[model samples]
Target: MNVKNVYIAYTNCITPLGFDVDSNVQAIANGVSGIRLQENSTLMTAPFYAGVIDSDKLNTAFAALSDAKATRLEKMMVLALDPIIKKSGVELNAKTALILSTTKGNITVLNENAVPVPDAYLHQLAQNIVDFFGFTTQPIVVSNACVSGIMAVSVAKRLVQAGLYDNVFVISGDEVSEFVLSGFNSFQAMSDVPCKPYSANRKGVTLGEAAAAALVTINNSEAKAKIAGDGSINDANHISGPSRTGEGLVRSIESAFNEAGVTAQNIDYISAHGTATPFNDEMEAVAFNRLGLNEVPVNSLKGYYGHTLGASGLLETVIGLESMARNKVFASMGYDEPGVSQPINVLAANLDTPVNCFLKTASGFGGCNTAVVFQKVNNGR
Candidate 1:
């Protein structure tokens, strides 16, 4: 069997930090966070800090594309994807594909009392986006909780490798709505302030909303980072809580390393799924330590992006790729103290270091965890 190499090239992100990739990275480089206290009388009894996109700004930016009636989530999906799709020059054909990832797609529409509940279905969300862009192939949706982002990337890589498509546009997004806000509140997982992943004083997750898109193809010229390895596993431990033993996450990373033909020592950085939740943070610490990756500098973008749910893994991967190209590792924002049980190194400050290879990991509801290994490509050709 012939295997084709896959690379991620164009990336676009829509968040409160800014509309595009550069703006988002600039905010991170400056140690700024998009999370803030949001006030809504009905959403919650108290103000909760969350990373939310400004409706006015989103509308203003999206106006350039179309003014058709659409759900906010749908608009966001299209917004994050349009630029990259236009830049790819890949036509919508049998060899091209569109993949969407999200934990909740168009859920807000249902909250607004849309006539048809199926309007919130994941397939409907994909169809809406496909209709906007006129994609000819059948739409694929990956909705594996928080792992949806990186997992979608893995799916795309395999599809291209399987000769099912030559290129794919992968987009993942979710919104911070009353439903999501109340759901986290039910778990008592909403942090009072900004989230602090792996910090001794870390309380809980601060949910954010954003849409991130990337173009993956076999053409090395479109390559910004090479997808070297991927692994997905389920511990079946608990629905909301991760394995206390870190069994699944540990195995996932080990498999990724094995697939990449590299060891923990070869990875320069780790973009982890640090939700700041007690179990999740501790679980990651244990897993990294057990895998002999305790010394590898790791950072969770949750502090900057506020745990953007399904959008986080892929967003962090894109940022990790850029961090490698820039030769800088952004600080683990909101982390001032070591909190986890293990001696894993959590980045405290931005450092100028070469990052050739990095690990992107995420653990979500239903005991699902995913890890993907990416390496910088010379000349990005």
Candidate 2:
């Protein structure tokens, strides 16, 4: 079998912060956060903080696309993918695949008055988007808890390597619905303010919603970031929490390192999955310490976008790629003092240091952990 190099060719983002990557990155560069205090009696009896997109703004963006008929979630997904597909100028043929990543696909339909076809089925969500864009191949939906985003990318790379497709477009999204809000609230995991990841006074998580898309292709010449390696492992530690000792995360990172022929020393930075939860942050710290990556500068995008569920992994990866292109390391927002017991270099301020290679990681419910290695394309190292 012939192995092909996978490269992220184009990217797009639609989040509470902004509708496109440039706007969102600028917001981060200026220390702006999308998270805000929200009041929805149906979702929660009391006020809660969350990163939620404005309904009017979403409608405007979707209206601009002449797709006003799509549901809010579907609009976000299509709005995310349309730009990348246009930018890539890649035709949707039999060899080109479309992948949708989300934990909840139109789950809001359950609480809304609109009755959708094949209602609430994730497959229908993917089909709706692909059907709009005229993809010849069957739509693929990935919904593995919060790992859905990066997992979709990993799956796309593997499929491309196996000659199932020459190009794959992965779009991941999840809306901040009443169901999700109540679910997190039930866990006592909803923070009252913008999350402070890896901070001494950190609280719990602030949920967010977003849709992001990237084109992964075998053509490395026009690549933004090269997908060097990727891996996933499950410890079955708990249903909603990660391993206390970071066993699964460590193994996942090691697997990617082995496949990419890189080491802890080779990594320039870590795009950590710091959810701002006490146990989650500590577990990530332990993992980095055990892997000899204690000093690697790391930041969690959650401080800006909050925990965006399945969209987070892909959203952060897209921003990480932008960081490499610009040579600017955005600060881990809301981080002041180290709270985790282990020694981990959590970024407190933005660094202008040049980055060549970085690791993106995500640990989700059901003890699923995934890590992927990416290197800057055409960097003059």
Candidate 3:
């Protein structure tokens, strides 16, 4: 048996800020936020802050690809993956695979007055994209709550390492809809203003919508970053809350560190899952402190993109890769002061620094937590 090293060949994303990776990077660098006060009776009764993509812009871009009837979420998924697949120039054969990550795939269809559509099924949503791209392998769906995106990366790495596939294309997306809005509102987690992750004045999460795609392959010709290691663990503590001791997140990071052969000191930066929720932020702070990463520069993109849910992990991962490549760390928007009981270095201002290795983490409902370590490729090593 032999092991293969996986590298991120290419990446792209569709967000309210921009369509491609470069645009999104510029937006973040400029401190631009996609989350805004959205007023739409169709999605929610009262005005709330969220990161909703422009429907017209999405349709206009998607129209160029295909006129075939597809749901809004489907359109986003396809749009996010199209450029990456074309750029990679990989053959769509049995040895190549497609993985879709989303917690609510086509879940908006249930809000319609008409009969339910088959696309509401996760597999069906995936099938639509698979058929559109003509992928020969059965599409794999990783929908483990909010960890779905980064977990998809872990899945791809394992598949390629095991020789199950030579190339794996991963795309993740979720749209802001009435269902999600109402669900968060019901939990009293919908913030009145744009979310401020890890801030004393933080209220709650501001929902967001986005689609991000990445190419995981044994090829390193155009590698953006090497996927060194990853881990996903469930604490089984609660249904919707995280562990009080941050045990799950701590273990998840430790697993990633052990596999990557790097400790907390080696992590130059951290893209944390700061959802702006009290429990989540505190849990992450405790976890980092437990892992002796308190002084590490950490930031959460939730302030700019809000909580993008299933799309968040990979979206942040893509942004983190860009940060490493550009040698700059974007500010953790909305973080004014320390809000958590534990001490952690939450970046309030953008820093121009060299980032060699970084960690991306996500925690979600059902006590799920995932962590992945990525390092910049040097001299094609």
In candidate 3, position 195 carries an lDDT of 89
What is candidate 1's lDDT per residue for 297-377, written digit by digit as tens?
999999998988888888888889888888899999999999998988898999889999999999999999999999888
After the best TM-score superposition of candidate 3, give how far the Cα of residue 117 lies from its true spot, in angstroms.
3.0
| Runs of candidate 1 exceeding 4 Å displacement | 114-116
Using alpha carbons, what is the TM-score of model 1?
0.98
Q: Which predicted model would earn the best lDDT?
A: 3
Tell how far residue 351 is off in model 2, in angstroms: 0.2
Total clashes in model 3, counting residue pairs 3 or more apart in sequence or in different chains: 0
215 Cα displacement, candidate 1 (Å): 0.6
> All candidates' TM-scores?
0.98, 0.97, 0.98
Q: Give candidate 2's error at residue 29 in angstroms.
A: 0.6
Which 10 consecutive residues of model 2 have the lowest summed lDDT? 110-119
lDDT for every model? 0.90, 0.90, 0.92
Q: Write the per-residue lDDT of candidate 3 for residues 161-273, one digit (tens) a residue.
A: 88899899999999998888999999998789898889998899999999999999988888888899899988779989999999889899999999899998899999999
